[model samples]
Target: MVNRYLPFFQGVVLNQATPTHHPIPGNGNVAVNFDDEPPLLEELDIDTGLIWRKAVSILHPLRSVDPSLHAEADLSGPALILLSLAFFQLLAGKLHFGIVLGWATAASVFLYFISSMLLSPGRGGRGDLSLYRCASLLGYSIMSMTIFSAVSLFLPRGGGLIFAVGMGFVLWSTRVCSRLLVACSGHGDGHRGIVAYPCFLVFMLFSLLVIF
Candidate 1:
């Protein structure tokens, strides 16, 4: 019966571990799985020196083509951008925190499929951008929309100006995201517009959220 539930036990069992790491065990060769141990503070890679520089760089689409802009795979910068977005939306009397995170995740997965799977090998864009990298890139890319959301709080409702500004920020995000995809994934500049389209749509969705 324990054999039938062995997988469940394995899932929860902590690795008290063996005698090699402790005094010699009286029991038969002590068996343990150390996978569940909480990481120590020293063991954690608490390095966050890059978050500020990377966040600042993300605000500039011109730097998007520079591979160095995305040298690290990080979610901290994106988390900050997302939190700011939620804050702005909250100020605008629309609490869309859940929708923002969900859509960001969906958009990341969608772009990952596009860049990592849909592009033919001949097109030179396949399997180069991992889902984690795509998520990180898009998370940073959304900073433009985050800014737009903040600006939108002061703008009048039902005006072309808001729409125009939203479109501009959407373009900004598209430029940064698409260029990063090309630069980081080694895709040719020729396919940049193709990548930009989906990115444009992703940003446009966020912009529309800002508009309404």
Candidate 2:
């Protein structure tokens, strides 16, 4: 009896040993090895050069901004810039990361309404702005404030130099943001003050966060 049942036991063992998973190539479903896939940086195809170029554009606040910088609306650089801003704030003895990020979101939304909602047309229009683009532009503009935050870390508290530097950085940030908005809006320089004013207020608050 034992010998007669051996074949049946062997068949059951063989079935259990076989793998159940198979590459089903149907209806957009395909087998993939997660370990074999590329890293997130490669998968997302992040262009470091583009990020660098945007930073370069932000550095020259007095110069005109390239409209192409807003074309793709990449957010990686902006995210990094904001994180840096928060970190700098953190280093300055303020745990305002949540507040910093929350305010950044609010600022982005505020600018989106000002820049895109007011300027964007119902249909195809020249130099239209999107919310993502607005956010990206605003993110890059904060670079100047981040610089102030870093510098403020080193300076003695209760000094007027921090105030002066913060004000200068706020203006620098406003100039860059306003220029980018105008360049992307196709409205020229006429509406820069409208755009810059809010930016000034936003960065001013950020400066205070750094100073205090």
Candidate 3:
């Protein structure tokens, strides 16, 4: 009897000593057993100086078109453009129109971002890419145009040189934007062309403003 009772107590002790596994909560009520997962990629912190550098790079095609370098650029280009527009407006004594146009410009930039994400194929579908990156690429692509717009305010309007410069910038920006999209989002030429259409419209609109 004592031996039998000893065996029973030992079995109880062993059962009690065994660790219990708890299910880890996942998406909803689902349980997952993964011990560890890879960490998510971190976003890049962009500043004004970085924005300027990215703008310069977009303007020059010979420069590296690596999308990773600009993975963290933000929507700061619209703000810069608005600031320059405001300065020009103030200079021309049309502060009211400047303020209105500034607001409109911000809205237009936001719309452009949304449209690009929606229209650009293969964006946010593969490998750590996101809509923020799309916005960053577009923003940086427009940097040179923004600067050119500001500078054009100082130059005499209606000159052949100004028209030529505006057209050149438009063409350059369109090509740069398409290439940047391809490099950053892995979009093919067709998709890049579709996405670059907005860039053309944007630069063309700016050109019109500069001209008339």
Candidate 4:
């Protein structure tokens, strides 16, 4: 089952990168093999790199009172605390399913970021996964907010609720499918390595079924 919203997700990822990286195709609907490293330049991708830089810029001063101390150190506890507070702020006004779904989505995003942290090969004292994890969570938060905001603008009241429920199911289904694809490949290569793509495609189909 092909993703009904594949184009949409691609659009989101692409909005952050350059036109040269326009067609950011995945293995159909399957989870990408973690072992198969991306190209050196596109590894972090332009979108992710800009985001990383901006976050570091904002984080540096807050993390250290000492002007001599670098921004890298501030990304730890101080960063996490700021992140948690931001989540609280976003949840402050509207504290219902929106909050629940927001946090759940964030938790799953953290899982992805943690996986990357373990997998990525960064150098120096700046290899703090926490910052990346926060970024991942923030990404999800933005996506969710944009989605619901759009829903409120275009969708009817009752229709919006139903659509929101469907969206939630689809999101959960995708996460499950991603996990299953990862499990099936068994962390190997050769013919078995390419299996993740097909598995992900199958999961994508399953997601459509769950969504519709």
Candidate 5:
């Protein structure tokens, strides 16, 4: 009976693990005992800072080559741009237009988040989500809504200036968030850094073009 339920226990342990770490390869014979103390940090070199560096290395290029990364990032980029654009429209005293634009931006962001969750390597146990990830998403969502509200309230005045500030925040926030996700996955290496950075630069440039 005990042997039959061993795998079940293992699954629970795995589910609770950090995204950056995986089972010690070839250690399957180990039983999952809940009463057992959590694994030691040193056992896996599970440093958040180290993991972040590794994530940048792994994701930078793979993301660059992966068509899905391009598609997903593009979706996120446009949503961010629209969100900023809506603020400008509202600031210009176009309330109805701004609301419509804001709504559209919101929808796009939802899709972007969904796609990112699905397509990014860490949505499941192998690339599991974490508190930090949830917080990052929450912050972005709040910023998006706040910008819209501000535009709605103060029109034909501070739209461009506020929009620019918002865009800067979006750019830096997305870059850092992506890096954190990579680090948490514990694959610290520059393998993916090349692609990710370039693609991000392109995205930034595009946004700048829109701004200017």
Candidate 6:
């Protein structure tokens, strides 16, 4: 009697010991590892939130003025911030979204190209930095102005205070961009000042439009 049940128990034990492998869809004969832990979905969310918060912090005048932060800047995070701000401006109906986005993107690309030309190769034979990096520096540096643009939409007419605040942000963004250029381009203060001038003009133009 025990012998008959012994066979069934052995079969069950064997099945349990042998891990089942599931073939991944569309990848023929490729089996997923049952022992491997699945990637955490929450990580992506946390990373995105962190990037957004950094973007917002960069908009602060005091924070953007920090040279250390400029060195660590990357394109993806700031680009997301700019795009989100543009979307909000569009929803506010204060300006044409297409024009705003088109100009902002164009300015970022144009400045990146122009600045790259003016920059010396990175220090210690590191070679020239990528356009994406330059664009990130410029894009994130100008984020202060982007915030001002979004905020101006909600301010009442004849608000001199709003205009003053926008100007301050514009100046701060220019300073940030200039400092970043000094860091990345390995250029002296004078050259960096020259490089940052166009950034100032661009922000000034945009801020004026938003303020008026």
lDDT of each: 0.81, 0.81, 0.61, 0.37, 0.41, 0.67
User: How close to the true structure is residue 96 of candidate 3, measured as C-alpha lDDT?
Assistant: 41
Error of 3 at 98 (Å): 5.5
Q: Per-residue alpha-carbon lDDT of model 6 for 1-212, expressed as tens digits?
A: 34675898978877899858878899998988856764574534335554565566565566535455455556667666567666756766654566656777777777777676666464322334466676677667657767776677677757778878887888887887777766665665667666777878877877776665
Ten-residue segment with the worst summed lDDT in candidate 5?
A: 65-74
Q: For candidate 4, what is the lDDT?
A: 0.37
In candidate 4, the residue pairs with backbone N, CA or C atoms under 3 Å apart (3 or more residues apart, or in different chains) clash, namely 1-205, 29-200, 30-200, 30-201, 63-74
What value does the lDDT take at residue 83 in candidate 5? Answer: 56
Error of 4 at 198 (Å): 18
**Candidate 5: stretches off by over 4 Å:** 1-89, 93-125, 129-171, 189-212
lDDT of 2 by residue, 1-212 (tens): 33665898978887899776556777465665667878888789788888998888778757877767666878899889999998988887788888888988899889888776545554223546777878888999999988888888888888888788788999898888888877777776777777788888888888888888
Pairwise lDDT winner, candidates 3 and 6: 6
- lDDT of residue 173 for candidate 4: 31
Candidate 2 vs candidate 6: the TM-score winner is 2
Off by over 4 Å in 3: 1-49, 61-64, 92-134
lDDT of 1 by residue, 93-210 (tens): 9989999999999999999988865455666655458889999999988989999998998899999999988998998999988878877777678878788998999999999888
How much does candidate 4 score in TM-score?
0.25
**What ranges in model 1 sit over 4 Å off?**
1-43, 61-65, 118-122
Q: Candidate 4: misplaced stretches above 4 Å?
A: 1-131, 134-141, 160-212
Candidate 4 or 2, higher lDDT: 2
**What's the C-alpha lDDT at position 115 in model 4?**
33
Candidate 5 on 1-212: residue-level lDDT in tens? 33565888877777788464345658964544545666676455444443333224323322422212211111233334345555564564544445444444443354345435543566332343343343333233233333444544443334577456646544543454344435444334342353244324433432332333
Candidate 1 lands at a TM-score of: 0.75
